[model samples]
Target: MDTRERLIESTRELLWERGYVGVSPKAIQQRADAGQGSMYHHFASKEALAAEAIGRSAEQLRAAAETQLSGPGTAVERIGAYLRREREVLRGCPIGRLTQDPEVMAIPALRAPVEQTLAWIRSRLARVLAEGREQGEFSSRLDPDATAAMIIATLQGGYVLARAAGTTEPFDQAVTGTLALIDANVAE
Candidate 1:
């Protein structure tokens, strides 16, 4: 690939592997096999490159979620599909991981994409819950927004738990348990 594309891709991979605080421009340049001048020419600074990488990652995540969200199924079914979708549980959610980075969150531009990515996922879940209510699949009393937040939180937290334990068991259990809870709440 070209220097610009290589730089962005390298940054994305490094960001996922090392996080915002851990990654450096020099490392990115080395990973990209591009010189300092090439990288800086494309991105004004490390933060600028990271911002672009985060934005790209966010877009990719949203697109993946939309695939499951728009598929043919009931609300819970679609959500289950999303939760069960293949992922690198050990690697963690690229966007979610950014939330743990003080450097990324401290910068408004860097944080925006991360925040928007998570908010979109939560909003999508809430919309699904709303649809379930309209279709008599869920109780009218169930709070869509709250439920959505809980679901997203469970997934995000699952990653943290799994990472801490150095195993995928916690992540799998979290999904299983969360799905069971959702199923239990569904209208019989």
Candidate 2:
């Protein structure tokens, strides 16, 4: 990879492994195998580099989700596919993990991508739920906006639960329960 790409990739990995406070320019340089001069040449500051990295991660997350969400299937099926998609459950959601970092949350530049990505996910799910209701796949009593929020919460919370327990079972159970709830609301 080029110096800029390597730097961005390294920053992404480092940010995932270590929060904003934990990542240093030196660490990024070493991980990217780039010189100090190269990093400074590419990014004006560490925050600048981190913002780019976080933005890249957010883009990837949205694209991955879109594939399943927009794929050929009923709304519940598509949502279930998204929930069951292969994930590093133990490692946690890349963007979701950033919410726990005080530094990341405190910095608007660093936080914008994370917040936007989450909001996008919720909005996308809400749209799909609305579509499902229109098609009679979901009951008219279902509230797409609220259900969408619950799904996102379960997903993000599932990651926390699994990471805290040092196992993937909690995440799996959370997803399964969510699927069951969606199924329960299936139109009669």
Candidate 3:
């Protein structure tokens, strides 16, 4: 691949592995096998390169989520499809992980993509819940926004628990529990 693409890909991988504080420009250059001058020519600095990489990851995630959200099915079915979507639970959500990075949170430009990505996912899920209510697929008492937040929080927190436990079981358990709750709320 070209130097620019190589650099961005390297940054993305490193960001996923080491996070913002743990990754450095030299490390990215080495990983990409590109020299300092080449990297600098393409990116003003490491932060700028990371920003671009994060943006790409965010866009990719949004697109993947849209596939499930727009699919033919009841709202709960589509949401279940999304929550059960194959994921590297141990590696964690790239966008969600950024929320824990001090450097990322300190910079608005760097944080925007991450925030927007999660917000979009949550909003999409909320819309699905609303649709389910309209169709009487869900109980009338269900609160879409609150339930959406809980669902997203559970997913994000599941990643944290799984990463700490060094296994995917915690993540699976969390998804199962969440699905059970949704099922309980579904209209018979």
* Candidate 1 lDDT tens digits, 36-138: 9999999999999999999999999999999998899899989999999998999999999988899999999999999988999999999998999889999
**What's the residue-level lDDT of 144 in candidate 1?**
90
Cα lDDT of all candidates, in order? Answer: 0.93, 0.97, 0.94
- Tens-digit per-residue lDDT, 54-130, candidate 2: 99999999999999999999999899999999999998899999999999999999999999999999999999999
**Cα deviation of 1, candidate 2, in Å:** 0.9
Q: Report the lDDT tens digits of candidate 3 across residue range 16-119.
A: 89999999899999999999999999999888999999999999899989999889999988999999999989999989999999999999889999999999
**Model 1, stretches more than 4 Å misplaced?**
none
Q: Report residue 79 deviation for candidate 2 (angstroms).
A: 0.2
**Model 2 residue pairs with clashes:** none
List the pairs of residues colliding in candidate 3. none
What global local distance difference test value does model 3 have? 0.94
User: RMSD, each candidate, Å?
Assistant: 0.8, 0.5, 0.9
Off by over 4 Å in 3: none
